[model samples]
Target: MQAVTFQAPGEVRVEERPEPDLLARDDAIVNVDATGVCGSDLHIYHGRVAIEPGFTLGHEFVGTVVAAGDGVTQVTEGDRVLGCYCSACGNCFFCRRGDFHQCDDGRVFGHGKTLGSLQGAQAERVLVPHANLTLRRVPEEMSDDAALFAGDVMGTGWHAVDQAGVRAGEAVAVLGLGPVGLCAVQAAKAAGAATIVGIDSVEDRLEAAEAFGARPVHLMEDEPRAAVKDATDGRGVDAGIDAVGHPDALELACRLTRKAGTVAAIGVYAERVQIHMGVVWIKALTLKSGQANVIGHVDRVLAMMAGGLLDPTPLVTHHMRLADAPEAYAVYDRREALKIVMTP
Candidate 1:
């Protein structure tokens, strides 16, 4: 099998590797059909998130189940499947409470030994741990391209809106317009937000957000704070989402949310960074931040995707063969593509 491997900072390669087999009673092996190149992959590509050399490197995947262990009951061999980026042991304390993202035995695929030594799906095959909890069958009507987002990007986007408690007739602001941010815009609108503000610097992303029913605001050219205030009649939006992992976007989200409103940081924050506690304290804001519970939200996200209430098809800007993964990674790292789907 040919898999994408992480070499070092600014490097990735497509190399022949051994195929995976079911190693646990709850495991399932998937014949990967399509896998996404995500922003997280970029972190490892840039050496920002350290991983061992030659480790398989991708998480978002849509494929067919080639085999399943006896313990896997939710799905079976021959079923079309999509895998969550991470898996959780259903018997854990957090899993018992529906907080599967925090399950005591959670393991993330393709993140090297630190995350779980699990090989990624950006290849001919992948091993899905806790199969019953990690893999969801893709509806027959959903395309491989569309179903690909259910496990990760779209799930994370929906988590932002869910965490913010977006309600009908409420105003919401989503900072950043990457694939996650664009998906956040759609999620906010689908969640019944009357006004959705999307902030980004790129013109194409701003245009795309507008097409998704958001009032796109250029982060540098336009004053996001003023725009949010004006849209809310002087008060800030009811909820603000930080879709960009940068600290500046997080700060802006906090500032754009009204008093007693919620600020949901759906972006990745791995290290300690300075935050303005005074702003949060003075405004009486409810701040929530962490990795998205993508496993927990996959079902709902899939439902929305199947219902056409949330379509991320447009975000698929590039479709390339798995053999071209090195170029795909380069394009993605260069910020030239929104979402790249690699077919094995």
Candidate 2:
């Protein structure tokens, strides 16, 4: 077997690695058919997120079940599956409360030993813990490329909208047009948002957002605040989503949200950054930030995909073999692709 490994900052290598096997009764082994190079992978590539050198890297995956432990019954051998980026102990207090993302024993894949020594799916195979909770059977009609998002990116986008309490006829603004941001646009529309402002600097991304039924606003060329205000009749959006994990983007989300509105920071934030507390205080804004509970939402996300209410197939910009993962990472790092699906 071969897996993508992080040897150092700005360096990822594709190398032979041992195959994974079930390590627990709740575990399952998957023959990875397709995986994605996500923005979080870029964090490790840039050394912003520390991980052990040579650690397997990548989480987003869709595959076929090859083996399952005795306790794993939700999926069986030969079942097509997609897995959440992380796994939670079903018995945890948070898990019992439907807050699986905050489960006390949650472990993230491909994040080195600190996140659970679980090797990543950017390989010929991966070992999934708590298979019944982590893996979801892919619908027969869903493509590998599209089903891949049900476990991670699309789920995160759905979480963003869900956290913000987006309602029918409400105005929403999504900042950033990456895969997650773009999916947020689609989710907002599906949730019945009457006005969605998709903000990005790239023309192509903005165009894609428009195709998703959002009113695209260029970050620099067009005034996002002005456009949002006009769209909301002088008031800012009822919900603002910061899909870009940067201080500036977070601040902008604050500025674009109306008083007493909600700001959902769905982007990855791993470091300390400054934000205007006074602004939030004066406006009485509600702020929510954290990782997505993909395991909890995968069923609904897949249902939406299966029903044709949400389609992320358009976000797939490239498809490559797992052997070309190094090159794929480089392309993604350079922003040359939107969502690169790598097959093993």
lDDT of each: 0.93, 0.94
lDDT of 2 by residue, 1-344 (tens): 99999999999999989888778998999999999999999998999888999899999999999999999989999999998999999998999999999988888989998887878889999999999999999999899999999999999999999999999999999999999999999999999999999999999999999999999999999999999999999999999999998889999999999999999999988789999999999999999999998888899999999999999999999999999988999999999899999998
Q: After superposition, how far is residue 13 of candidate 1 from its true place, in Å?
A: 1.0
**Positional deviation of 36 in candidate 2, in angstroms?**
0.7
Q: Pick the candidate with the highest lDDT.
A: 2
The TM-score of predicted model 2 comes to 0.99
**Candidate 1 at 138: error in angstroms?**
0.6
lDDT of 1 by residue, 1-344 (tens): 99999998998999999988789999999999999999999999989999999999999999999999999999999999999999999997899999988988888989999887888889899999999999999999999999999999999999999999999999999999999999999999999999999999999999999999999899989999899988999999999999987889988998999999999998899888877999999999998888889988999999999999999999999999999998999999889999999998
How many Å off is the CA of 125 in candidate 1? 0.4
Q: Which 10 consecutive residues of model 2 have the lowest summed lDDT?
A: 112-121
Model 1 residue 261 CA deviation (Å) reads: 0.4
Error of 2 at 333 (Å): 0.6
